[model samples]
Every structure is written in structure tokens, then in C-alpha cells.
Target: MERSINVLALMKDGERFIFLYDEQSTPQLLQTLGRYAADPEMSFSWYDAAVLSQKVRRLKESQERTTPDVRRSA
Candidate 1:
């Protein structure tokens, strides 16, 4: 199935950026957008939703790698 996502807003100042997506979009699309928002390189550069989503995913993965894993063994 082909789904369409609308980009409500894409604002950036200096190194910071904010992306707003339409509420009608699917959760999968939203998840993808979140991924791109975390990228250091692509975070600031995205032409479309698809590309942005890719960047967001990469950014999220990078963040996960740096995050400390907490587990307790009993």
C-alpha cells in the first residue's frame, strides 16, 4: 500500500531544527520522522519526508549506541 505523509513544518535556526508532521499520517511515518530528527548530519538537511525519515532513523540508531544500557542480574 502507498501512503502519503504531509510535512506541516520544517524550521531550523543555526544547528537546531524542528519538524512538524500532519496528524492524519500513519504511526509508521511518524516513527520514521523521529529517526531523522536525531541525526547530526542529516538532521539539518532533508528535502522530503522519505529522505527525512531515513536520516531520522540513522540518528536514532546512533543515539541508541551512545545510550548507557542498564540491566540488573538477580
Candidate 2:
């Protein structure tokens, strides 16, 4: 299966963060690392992929909650 970059950061708050991008574009981001790494004189390094998938499945039986049936009388 083709893989997409999905970096999730689970924060203290009940919120999920997802960073999706291409591996080839990482060199641009390395500039923020530091001057030593930012200098064009330095070479950039590449890393392998480490991926994880989140799965959701509902197994237990549950009643379907719906709005109460409405009736009108004239």
C-alpha cells in the first residue's frame, strides 16, 4: 500500500495533531534546526520511514438513538 506521511502528536489536551508531508521536502525544514545544519556547505541526511496506523471498529451491539417520532394534529 502506498504510504502518506502522517505524524501525530498527542498533546495533554484531548486533541490530535497530524503532519502530512513528503520525505523529499525535509531538507527545507532542516534549516530551522541550526546554522551548522543550515549552511549549504553541510550535507543533509535522510532517514527511513516509521509509520503507524490508527484503526477504529465498533464491535458491541448498541441501540440506535434517534429523535422522538413527531405527530401533528390539526
Candidate 3:
């Protein structure tokens, strides 16, 4: 059975972009990530996918708890 995974970071030049993906479609995700690391024009780094996913989940939960519900009448 297929499972969901997240792509938590993308690096280019001196910048890192943080992203959360509930699922990824590529069959060779790690290989693709490695290619990015090897590319001379780019720089790349990552957190362990499992660890980063967990962190993202916790942050989302915290944000949800702190954020006011807009639908509730004031």
C-alpha cells in the first residue's frame, strides 16, 4: 500500500524554503533530493523526513489552538 510523506525543505543559493506536503508523488524522492544536493548551482539540506513531519504536526496543532475561530459570532 502507498503511504503519504512530506517534503519539508528546498534549498537554492543561500536560501532554504520550508514547505509541508501531505503527500509526494515521485517514486524516487530520495534520489531526486540527492541530485539537488549534488548540483553545483544549488545548495541543499534537510531534516530527517520523519522528524520534520512530526515537528510540523506539532506546530500546526499549536497554531490551531492559538488562532481564533473566525466563524464564531463575536
Candidate 4:
């Protein structure tokens, strides 16, 4: 069975954005999107949830603030 394409939201450097295309697309998909990636500055690449998760992790790690402690005040 072929995996379907699903648009997903991805965050980079605290910025949120949407990414198009399915993460499980075959090599043929790469060939199809090659034109979009031809530019040196702007290019589209396939990024799965795992990859995106890592990026989010890194962003969280790089932060210089302490995690907020949720507590009830008397």
C-alpha cells in the first residue's frame, strides 16, 4: 500500500510553519520535488516527524530559561 501525503505543522527556532508532502514518499517523489529544491536559498526537503521532533528537542535544549513550574498559589 502506498503511504498517503499529509500536510504537517513544523516548528523551527520557535517559529511555526506548515510543511507540505508526505514524509514516506518514494524516490519518485524526490524527482518530482527536485525543481523546488534547485534554488540555493529556498529548497524543499522531506522531513519526518522523528526529524522534526529532534529539531524541536534541540530548540528546547538551546533555550536559556527554566521550565515553568505550574503550581497553585494560596
Candidate 5:
């Protein structure tokens, strides 16, 4: 299957942050959010990261639930 880039964007308080990642890169994206939250200079906070992380996980879970499995049952 061809991997496609997924976009998750946030626009708050006149600031916009766009994240581009593939399905396989969700783990990395989660970690990146944490890093952003830890940076004292950045506007991103732990709350933002937590909320976005939930979004990411829910989106992935929904997709997995909808997609059909190719394997046949024994």
C-alpha cells in the first residue's frame, strides 16, 4: 500500500501550527508534540499536546476500525 501524508493543523491565538505525517509516523508525531510542549520559548503547552495527541489516536483508531482486514478466518 502506498503511504500518504496526513495533515493535522492548529490555529490558536493568531498562531498556526501544521503537522505533516504519515500513518506510520504517528509515534514520532506524538513525541514531537511533547518536545514542543517542553520548550520554554514556544507557545505550545502540555494541554495542547495532550488534546492533539488524543485527536491523533482517535483518528487512527477510527480508520483502523473502518478498514477491512484481508486475512481469512480459519
Candidate 6:
């Protein structure tokens, strides 16, 4: 079993924003995006967070649809 690391990046107005996370860390990543959006000094905006969050959710959903569930009954 290998691990998958998801990398998301955005470059705008000469600035680059990058995030690395696994499926489990997505919520934390979303929170971090919110924090960035709230900071007045950064160029990151709520729209950016919303867009990225949608992307993250879609990726997760696609993965879920492809993977199979295995269970044992005793």
C-alpha cells in the first residue's frame, strides 16, 4: 500500500501559492486557505479559497468513486 500526496498550486500576479496534502489533511488545508484569505497582507482571497476547496472536494469524490470497499463479516 502506497501513500498519495496531492499537490495544488496557483500562480497569480507574480506570486505563487502552493499546498501539499493527503486526503485526510484536506480539512486542515481548507482552514489554512481561510486563514490566508483573511489576512489583509496576502493576495489570497475568499474566491481563491472557494475555488480550491471545490477542486479538493472533486478530487476526493473521484477517488471515492474509483476505490472499492472491502469488509469482513464474522
Please provide, for model 3 over 40-64, each residue's C-alpha lDDT reduced to its tens digit, 9 standing for 90 to 100: 6654534344444455667557756
Candidate 6 lDDT, tens digit per residue, 29-73? 999999999999999999999899999999999998876654432
Which digits, one per residue and each the tens of the lDDT, describe model 5 over residues 1-74?
Answer: 66778889888889998999989899999999999999999899999999999999999998889867758432
**lDDT tens digits by residue: candidate 2, 1-74:** 34345233322245443334444444432333334334565342121011111210011111112323235321
| Per-residue C-alpha lDDT of model 1 across residues 1-31, encoded as one tens digit per residue | 2333344345556444445443344466666
What shift in Å separates residue 54 of candidate 3 from its native position after superposition?
0.2
lDDT of 1: 0.53
Evaluated at residue 34, the lDDT of candidate 6 is: 93
* Per-candidate local distance difference test: 0.53, 0.30, 0.54, 0.46, 0.91, 0.90
Off by over 4 Å in 4: 1-47, 65-74
**Residues 1-74 of candidate 4: C-alpha lDDT, one tens digit per residue:** 34445444645566565645544443334344444345455434344344544544454454414434335321
Candidate with better lDDT, 1 vs 6: 6
RMSD (CA, Å), each prediction: 11.9, 16.2, 9.5, 13.1, 1.8, 2.0
lDDT of 4: 0.46
Name model 5 segments beyond 4 Å from true: none
Count of clashing residue pairs in every prediction: 5, 0, 0, 0, 0, 0
Off by over 4 Å in 6: 72-74
What value does the lDDT take at residue 41 in candidate 6?
99
lDDT of 6 at 29: 99
> How does each model score on TM-score?
0.38, 0.24, 0.39, 0.26, 0.90, 0.91
Worst 10 residues of 6 by lDDT: 65-74
